[model samples]
Target: MRRHRHAKIVATVGPASSTPDQLRALFLAGVDTFRLNFSHGVQADHAKVHAAIRDLEKEVGRPIGILQDLQGPKIRIGTLQGGRLDLQAGETVRFVLEGADGDKQAIPLHHPEIFDAVVPGQELLIDDGRVRVRVTGPERTSITAEVITGGPISNRKGVNLPGTLLDLSPLTEKDRADLAFGLDLGVDWVALSFVQKPSDVIEARGIIGDRAGIMSKIEKPQALDRIDDIIRLSDAVMVARGDLGVEIPHEDVPARQKELIRACRLAVKPVVVATQMLDSMVNAPAPTRAEASDVATAIYDGADAVMLSAESATGRYPVEAVAMMDRIIRSVEGHKLYHSIIAASEPGEEETPPHAVATATADLAEAVRAAAIVAYTASGTTAARVARKRPAAAILALTPNVATSRRLSLLWGAHSVLTEDVDSYEEMTTKARHHAQDEGFAKPNDIIVVTAGIPFHSAGNTNNIRLMQI
Candidate 1:
């Protein structure tokens, strides 16, 4: 298949379209990737859907990416004492770690660490702000709250504290197990939800061990605060606007989305804009005009992908949603500024540690009319940097880590190849040239651009470049 100017499309699989026929139809409708949300289904269901996708790929003779999303740490209040409780606006309610075991007057707050981080007067929004509480006391297991808005409190309601930094870690035991499962399943990508720090990416990578690519979901405000570090550590990123909209001010989401997409583009990592693009299509056969504009805006902003959550996953018009997204992307891409935006948004040559050297190498590639640019990156940084320029020739990214390889597949105008470790710059260049030739990416007498560092596999150690003939 010919490469697309933008990155790709990731469609979630859900009840409305889980059958083999519907999956195949969606694929034909132009979904480049499929996301299996582990939060909703069991392993068996996912496995079946996976098998069907593989079957469809074989039938069509094209590779399709699969992303398995792990359900990260979800903090919420446990059951209410009485099936439901109504709190008045002026009432001071107590939220405790250990409350009445029965089901009537009290509600149980599960995460004690959250209690530690919350300070006086912090706003805690529950059920997407349908209910609001202002923290008032002691800041311990036993804390006092004044009901900002009265609503019925039920079992397992989600809690969001916008201003307070929760002491709890992003990943829980369940997330670790889910990561392992995704790895074992041989998924192309694993999306880490609620990622708040670089350490979370590192921990997930350690467990995944290169089996699958890691895409950090930027949903929480804390995650946005540390975005640069998280982007550097992760293979790719997902603009999960669902929880993100809930966690931050609604008016800020559009600006934040643009900022995130721009940052990822500059970093040369694939970024997917997700959630509510075609929300109206969840029940209706067609999307709202505003939603269409939203999808087009993401495309024009140079996002690597635009994702559909409930639209293609559980909507009544699953196929239609996929088709509409494909049409919208194509229409947006027709604009001349679309390509220019992508180029102008790329990071400058000065951004890389080995910028001067890599740029010199790239210039040599152009001067000699090289067949491709070969980038040997340990953390995939150099490869991404090369891709940002949108070179005339294909960019070949060779990585020892399979996760990085798969992740790069989503980047624009870049192809990824997994390889054994290379100990030296010379070995890396040689292997890269050989791989380019063997893979039919380059021919004899063709020049190839190669970029790498002296101490291979060291993060941020890139400092060497070369131009060689195949």
Candidate 2:
């Protein structure tokens, strides 16, 4: 089934929607991609879900993308006595870097890098910022801090360092193992978490090679410092706003999200705005008006896909969440200002061949009133560029690699299909014409524009554009 809207939906699968039937229902409900979060599930659990998604893909006769989000260096404070304790405000606490022994006065902080990385006056957030502490420098192998907003501190709650740039690898040992397993399972994308610099992306790319497209998760403030470089190296980027909200001021997320979307749009990389989008649907039957507006705003800002984390992963209304998000997108796209909103992006950037061709594709289609724009690519780059235009007609991306086709499924206005390799330019147009007609995107006398690089199968060589009649 074709989507009525341009933007895509990425639904995460978990215990709430792991069965093949449930996954297929989600697909029918307008989920374009399935994200298997490796943070909570075991390899065996993911293996089952991966197989199920693939099976559903075959049954639907459409390419579906699977993204394995790697859990980065997640720091947590060790347990307190009686498994919990109440620390009042203004209480001084000692956080040790080792041993799981501690009381209300002190606690075992498992991640030593936190002690080595943080300095005096930096804030540490625990339990998702419910408890806050201000550092007072280190004390031997521990760090002393005064609780700024103390409450009930529990065992093994997550910790967040707002501005501390830790000497931590984006791929932890567990992440490496999880990535290897997901790659072996043939996942379409791998999202690297807590990426601090371009080198982190380079390292993940070196290990990943071409096995899977690396999706860098932008959550840390440090990641914001090198977003351009990170976008340059990675295949895609996810604006992970949960931790990002903690790492930076809550009000700054909107501006930063817009900045990231614009940057990715300029580069023609797929960007997903994730974390708590439609989160209230986890238990409720419908989302609040504010949540509805939030989803609409992301689409209005041109995020390729808006993600549903807990809402789809473990929500009681998984299908409703997908359907709701789909409705919100379609409703926004139906607005008269949708196209104009997309047209308001920054326009002073230098143009490349691909950019020129993409801009020309949209203009050419309008000039000829063409049926669609067909892009033949190897890495889906050309199709993504074309999609960045938010063309008036559909964008068909034909690729020989199934993984490329699947990954392209998440792109706005991009309908990915696996096809035979095109060895010559003539074959490219002829095949595109036939597919366009066969796929019902065009009629016998319809005019359509075709774009692809010469020297077939070579990536980033989109120098050829043809306007053809089927």
Candidate 3:
């Protein structure tokens, strides 16, 4: 299916929208990518959803992307006395590394990395910042903190350390198991959560190895310190504002999101602005004005995609959420200021032949008022480079590899089609014209821009550009 908008939509699959029929409805409603959240379901559940997505893709005659989001290490307080405790502000609380059922004197924190990394004066947020405490004393086995913002905290409540840099790998035992399962299932993309360092992406890449695109979720504040390095190592990135907003100041999240999106665009990698966009749609039939603005803001900032988490997964109006997101993107992209804003924010081109050719292709396409920019990509790099320009023309990404086409689903303005490889220059023109008209991107008299490598099938060698009539 061809979408009118450039920015893609990623909708998560959950109990509310797992049925094959429901998935088909969602797809028709405008979901480009389907996310299978490993945090809430078993492998069997995900396998069923994956199968349904593949089935829907076949029925719709389009490439659909499946993203496997691995739940990383979860650090939380252990079991507590009577399963809960209430502490008042100005009271000192002790958190110990080893405890069965803790009382007000000492609360159980099973993760030792927290104790080892935390220092005095660093803030510790519990239960999504409902309860805040500052470290007054940090010892080998226990940490004493004074409650700054007091509230009732129950067992296994999450903890966020904004200042402490813990020596913990983002991938836990469960994440490793999930990763292996997802890879074996032939997922198109794998999203790594709680990425704090570039080494985490490197560690995951050692296993993925060109099988799927590795997306680093920028949720931890520490990640922002070395974000350039992490983005360089990753195939894509997600601006996860859920935990990121909790770790850093709420006022800084918007700026960080803009910066992250800009950085990814500059690096020519796909970036998704995720978490709580259109959150009200989870129960209501329509999104709030603020939520609509939030989604539109990402589009105006030139994000490759905007995502729906709970709004599409376990929400009362999953299909409606997708449809609403589609409407918002289309409206924002059609705005008069959209062209100038995106063009002004566009990153400078890299000094390389592939980049230079891709730039020229976009310039020529826009100058000629071409109906489409057809990119014959073996590894999808050519399309990605062209999409980095965010041209007004539609990107018709043609590839022989099904996996590459599937990965392109997350890219901006890309309408991927699985096609046979072209061996000669004449074959390229024929196929380009055929697909352009077949996909409704161009009419018989419409002009289109074609770009490919010189050797025809060689990957990442995008040095050729042509202007052809459809």
Number of the top-ranking candidate, with lDDT as the measure: 3
> What's the lDDT for all of these models?
0.78, 0.89, 0.94
Tens digits of lDDT, candidate 1, 1-470:
43433456789999987899999998888777889998888888988998898788678755667899988887788877665777778788877778556333246787887877888888888887888888888455677888999888778888888856666556688777776677777889889988877888888887776677789999889888889999988878999998889888899999999999888866667888999999999999898899999999887777778898999888889999989888887777777676667556655556545655656666677678888888887666776666556555677777787556656656655666768879966677779879889767789888887887778767545677777877
Q: Where does model 3 exceed 4 Å of error?
A: none
Judged by TM-score, which candidate is best?
3
Model 2, 1-470: lDDT tens digits are: 56778899999998999998899999999999999999998999999999999999889899999999999888888878988978789988888877647785569897767877877898889998999989886766788889899799888888999877898888889999998899999999999988999999999988899999989999999989888899999889999999999889999999999999999988778999998889899999999999999999999899999999999989999999999999999999889998788888743443787778777887798789899899998989889878877776888889998989999988988988899999987889899998898777899889999999887878978888899998
Candidate numbers sorted by lDDT from highest down: 3, 2, 1
TM-score of each: 0.80, 0.97, 0.98
Score candidate 3 by TM-score against the native. 0.98
After superposition, which runs of candidate 2 have C-alpha atoms over 4 Å from their true positions?
Answer: 346-350
Show model 1 residue runs off by greater than 4 Å. Answer: 3-5, 81-83, 101-105, 351-383, 390-409, 413-470
**Alpha carbon lDDT at 416, candidate 2:** 85
Positional deviation of residue 240's Cα in model 1 after best superposition, in angstroms: 1.7
As a whole number from 0 to 100, the lDDT of residue 252 in candidate 2 is 100
